[model samples]
Target: MGANDIFGVPGDYNLQFLDHITHRQDLKWTGNANELNASYMADGYAREKGFAAFVTTFGVGELSAINGLAGSIAEHVPVLEIVGAPTNNVQNNGSLVHHTFGDHKFDRFEKAHRQLGIKSARLDGEHAIDQINDVAQYIYETKKPAYIILPTNLVEMEVNKSLKDSIPNLFFNKEMNSENSFEQIKSSINNIENPVIVMGHEVDRFNVFNDIKSFSSNNNIPVLDLGLGKGNIDESFSNFVGTYNGQISDESVNKYVANADTVVLIGAKLTDSVTGGFTQQFNEQNTIVLNYENANIYGKSVDKDYNFKTIMTYLSKTKLDLSLPSIKNADNVSEIKPSNNKLTQSFYDKAISQFTSADNTIVAEQGTSFFGLASQKLPKGAKFFGQPLWGSIGYAFPAALGNQIANKNRRIVLSTGEGSLQLTIQELGLAFREKLNPVMFVIDNSGYTVERVIHGMNEPYNDVPNLNYKLMPKAFGAKEDEYDFIEASTENELFDAIFKAKEEKDKLVLIQVNMEMKDVPEQLAKTAKAFADQNK
Candidate 1:
């Protein structure tokens, strides 16, 4: 209900619905090239604006967007998916429609959405307003995606004008009283000596960054974030340690987290990637896991009803002698000396680190882009978005589009591999059409570089057809003066391209950096080897 922007593609069934959106001067409609891209844009927008919506036609369009919807569900983002269906008469009569499979079963799509969505409903004439309210409430409360089917005939149907003028109050009052759960956590904190805090993506999902930051700072506890929790905390905080992912973590981070007497994990998911292929050693016995609605201490569930924010607020006010030994700081970025002027991953990493600022929102795609950018330090207030658990390639490009649409003032930097970019490259035209300016860096390393590092070093299955990435802007119908496109193979060329991109801030910029196929980040190499060994 509070969404500021809508993203979707136009279709026959959805045209009437889009007419309303187009007529409204207060609302902005982002017409994406494809339904999948639209859904991804909505996901990115939701991450920034807290809530977002995307519309699509019935079967074909909705099916294409299911992947992005599933990703929203996995990441706990609240996205409203409005599907435009056929006429109400056609649905009721079970007629074989173009979007339907000739079986007259119009509920198939709604049923499919239930698996990936927290809640779903089909709009009926008598109860459409109630259905919309319930779906919106569920989405806001659960922070997950919800699906709504809108028949073409019902686009202009209205029950009451008052429903359009006001939205239901969905925000719940914060509970101020500290309960037994808070006492239990306080006791746990007091009982343990060498306690540390481990944060995850949920901290951002639940909007508790400020509370967690206050608690961590007030207690002088060293904080380590999982991969997905990169931008949740101020990286410049003195008490903040580097990212922790078991053996893949920095040596100091691994030692501090692995050796801690009591590990406090807040909104953390022990996914395979975050835990370095499940290589982490700490178990429930030594960990206090705090979720959105519950708390677990030393393998025992707290039987009291507890809110995550309330618990964090209570912890911030409590006093504790957290005078543990300071963790060893990670080494600063080493000077990059590319041999024979060849640009290495280290050089690129350094360049990215230098280019990023507080006003930037960086999105990295799966594969080399994700692993390579993993260790780069983000500036204060800079947001980082990556789908590490979902690991969907080409997610960053459309996500960058949505993010830029949501936060028009901030610079959106998208780092994606050439191979991965091909999957969703059609969205580039939408960026041009929308006049959205985002700095896009495509790593042209031939093919699936991350996969090659894991297995099949020289297999044909890993090779991808090479395309001229610099010419994509022209192919996408961008005017000659509307965009800047640069290709770089050497260190100086790459640096100059990045510098030029920074200077040309008013227009979309694409920089294609070429590297050897075998070149991979050091951390990625180690993790790949671990995965390979385990599989063998």
Candidate 2:
């Protein structure tokens, strides 16, 4: 509801609504390349900001956007999906629309949305305002995607303003009676000798990111952020430990976490990707989970449901033995020297670590870009976003575009592969047209290296077409002073690109880094081997 900008694509059905958007002086419209990328941009905007609005035409456009909306809801992001449908007369007469199937099924698309667990409502002139308020409240309560079907005829529907607007806001918004839940957590945690906190994604979604930092630092609890919640906490904190992704984590981290007497899992998702194919050693009996729907206090159920922020606030005040056994620091990972002749995944990983800082917000694609940078130690205030669970490629770049709009002060660093970039390369024009400055790295590894690492080495299915990436800037209509492009195949050239990108802060710098097709990051290699083993 607090959207300053809306991301969308115009279609025949949505033309009238686009006209309204064009006249709005308070809001800016971000016309994306397609509906899917538009949805992805909205998802990223919601992740950076509190809420987001995405518009698309019904049927074709809405179906195209389903995947991105599904990812947002799976990751617990609040996005208001607005669909411009046909006129009420057409829908009522069961007229087959141009975007729909040949059969007279007007509700098929909305039915598809329901399968993805999205709450949806179709509006009419009589109940337009009521439906809008209800859906808005639902999105506010649950950090998930909500759907609104606005018929073309109802776009100009006249309705009385809400009488409830005159009333105070506090009467409508009330927190649950978490006093008993707080007492339960406080009592159960007092007996804990060695407590370990595992930061999860919901912490940021609830706007209580600083609360976890306060709780961890005040109680001297060693923090291990999961892969889904990467950059959720300050990596430079004294109490901060490395990311714990089951067997893929460092030996010291696995050992320390295994030896912990009590594990506090706050808003964490122990999914396959986050837990390295469910390799986590900890059991439910010794784990304390604090989430929105599920908040179990070490196998003991609370009186009722408690939110993450409230649970964390109470857990921080509980007494625990802060002076526990000393935790061992992980061994240093050797950085590849930039003096090397060729650029390797390990060197790129090191370069990513070097390029990161407090002023940066890094978005890595789901392939090698994510695997290589997942384990890197970010600066104290740097933010990271990826689609680990969704595993969607081509999501980072457009998402970075929306993120830049949300916070213009922070620099957005985008790392993506060539194969993935080809999916939404048209959106590159939107970034250039908006005059946004994002340092984008397009890795040209010849093909889908991540898929090859898993299976089918040398298969043609994984190969991608190669093109001169340097010409991309001019193709996107970028002006000479507004953009720069570099192709880096060697270590020296890569460093040159990085230095120039950082130096030219106002220009949108795109660096194309070439590597061997067989090359893979250390973390990705091991994980892929295990995946290949399962298929065998």
Candidate 3:
């Protein structure tokens, strides 16, 4: 309900609906080059602005954007996907449409989307208002994506103006009977000697950063964030440890988490990527897990109404053993003395770590970009965006566009591999059209570096045709003075390019950093080995 912008590509079926969006003075319509990028932009906007929507035509358009919608679902982002369908009579009579399968069947797309979305609804003129309100409420409460099919004939259908006043409140009502669950959690905490708090993506999804900080700081407990939960907490906190990625974590972080007597996991999902190929060794019987809707203590389930925030509030007052061990910060980048002077992952990591600040936002792509930035430190108040669970490449490009739109005052730095950027590179034109300035670095590794490490080392399938990345800005309609394009093949060139980009604040800067195909992040190499073994 609080969404400020809509992203989509205009189509014949969706034109009428888009016209209304353009007429609204309070809302902005971001027209992307393609539907996939549009959905990704909406996903990024939702992650930053709390709520976002994207519109697309039925069938082809909806299917094209399905991958982005799937990413939002996997990551628990609240996005409303509006699909513009044919007229009511056309659907009622099963008439063939351009985007249809030519069998007069139009419901197949909605059926497929239901599996990926929290809920799917097709609006009917007679009950459109009721259906819209129900779906909106569900999306707000669950913080998940939802699909809505808007028939072309219903675009101009008028309804009671008072329906807008009936939108339900989005907050969850505190349960009075949660005291029993609180007592169980307190007993579990009291039984443990060294308990550590682990933060996850849900902590940011529910907007409870302050609550977690208060609880961890007041209790003097050490806090550790998972890979996906990067930038969700203030890393500068005295008790805040670095990210814990099971086997891939730093020696100090792994020791603190692995040896703890009791682990308090808050809003965390131990996915394979985040857990170093499912290498975590914690005992569920000694863990207290708190999520959005429920809590579990030492393998015992709490009441369904016992939310994470309420449990954190209770734990703030309850005293547990404060004998937890302090953890030192992990040095993500190792000092490298190159023998041949070829660009390496260490140089890229250090350069990005130096460029990032509290006023910036970093968007990393799925493969090397995601794994490489896992250990990089961010300044306080900085935001990080990535698709770890979905593992979607080319997501960060358009997502960076959306993030910039949502937070226009902050600078955006996007790190993506060349292989990943090719999928959604058309969004660069949209960035030019919108006059948004984001410093984008394309890691020209020659191919899919992460895939090469996983199963295709020296394989032809992992290779991609290299393109002249510096010419892309001009091709995207950027004036010579409106953008800066550079190629960095050495450490000094990379450093100078980034420094120059920072000085040119008013224009978008595109930097192509060249690296060897085998130059992969250390953590990604280990994770890839595990994946290769598992697949074997």
Candidate 4:
């Protein structure tokens, strides 16, 4: 509901609808290179703004954006996907459109989207407003993606003044305990001596960060988080422990969570990647899980599908007598010293840790960047996100672009592998066109380093073409004064690039960090081995 700008591409069917979107003074349209890139940008925008929207044409355009919407669905991000459909006349008559197959099946695309667990409705002029409201309400409640197919005839549909009144009533109604009903888990947890709070990505999607943070602080609880939702809580908080991903977690952090008598797991998803290939074994009897659909309290379960904020508000107010065990809450930052030696993976991790700060919004890609900085502590007020479940390649680049668009004042920083960057590298041109400046750390490790860690160390399929990443900005039409490129092959050179980037506030800095193709972070190597074991 809070989307002020929409990212999309134009096609023949949606050209008419595009005019109205373009004329709206409240919205700015960013025309991307492709629909997939547009959808990725929308996903990024929603990560920052809590709600995002993107437009695409009926069949061809919509299909291209479906993967990005699927990421929104799996990660619990709220994104509104507006599709421009062929005229109702064509739909009613079963006539073939230019974008459709010759068989004249216009409903194929929406049906395909239904398989991805999203709410979709093709709109006609009569019930368009009502349908939009229904789909939007579901998206907000579920914190997932929804599709609204708008026909060409409805682009400029004339309505009465009564319909204008409906605009102000767009907010979801919330009472003290209506949408979210909670019964106290008071007696179950009263005897708990050691309690730990483990958070996940849902805290970001439902906008419940403040309530959870306050609850953890007031109760004097140690907080551990999964890697998917890294920046939802302030790592600088006194009670914060390091990130926990099953056995891959820092030994002390994992041990603390394992030894806790009461574990409060808030919206944490135990997917294969986050759980170290289902290696996490929790004591269900001592755990209290508060998630999107239901609550599991100390071996007792609630059937009510509750929202995160209200449930958290109820939990924060409940009194619990918890005598916490002595736990060490320290940052998982790599402090590898700079030297004349070549940049190894450990030094790369350290360089990234120093490059990030409270002033930056960091978007780390799934493979190297995300796993490399999994437990790297951030300065307070820094925002971080990556696609863990969806695991799409080249997502962070365009998403960073969209994030910067949503919050123009924040400095956008990106850490991505070279192989993934090649997929959406064209978005850099669009960012330059929009007059956006972002600092990018391109991991030039020669090929797909992550895939090599998983199974194939020397497979030809995992190898990528050789290309110089330094010339990207100039080739993308960034003016000489608008951009700078730095190569960080040695440890000293790596730190030099980070310091130089801090000084140049107005220009885009692209750092080509050279490392061995086979080298990877220790955590990622272990996680990949666990994943490989599970597959066998």
- Choose the strongest candidate by TM-score: 4
Clashes of each: 0, 0, 0, 0
**What is candidate 2's lDDT per residue for 1-536, written digit by digit as tens?**
56889999998888888888889999898899899999899988888887899899988899899999999988888999899999989988889669988687788888888988999999988777768878887777677789999888987766556756733342244555578877777677667887788878887877665777677766777888888988766787777788887877878678758878888888878877777667787878898888877788767677765665667666655545455644455537555557758898888878888877788999989879988898888877899989888888888888889988888899899999999999888888998898899999999998899899998879999998987878888898988999999888889889889989999999999999999999898777777777677778
Error of 3 at 221 (Å): 1.1
Per-model TM-score, in order, reads 0.95, 0.95, 0.95, 0.96
Global Cα lDDT for candidate 4: 0.83
> Scored by CA lDDT, what does every candidate get?
0.83, 0.83, 0.83, 0.83
- Candidate 3, residues 41-117, lDDT tens digits: the string is 99988888888999999888999999999999888889999999998899989987699999978888988987654
Candidate 1 lDDT, 1-536, residue by residue in tens: 56767888888999999989988988878788888888888988988888999999999999999998888888778899899989889998999779789997988888888865448889888888889888887877777889999998889886777766567455664565658878878788878888888888888877876776777767677888888767777787777777877778878778778778989999988887667777776888899999875788998887566778778777767667566554455547554544349887768877887778898898988777777776677777788878888877878899888989888899899999988898999988988898888999899898999889889999999888889876888899899888998888888888788889889988999988899889998777877887788889
Indicate the worst ten consecutive residues by lDDT in candidate 1. 331-340
Alpha carbon deviation, residue 476, candidate 2 (Å): 1.6
Q: List the pairs of residues colliding in candidate 4.
A: none
| Residue-level error in angstroms, candidate 2, position 80 | 1.3
Q: Runs in model 3 with CA error above 4 Å? A: 168-177, 316-318, 321-340
Q: Which residues of candidate 1, in runs, are more than 4 Å off?
A: 164-168, 174-178, 325-340, 533-536
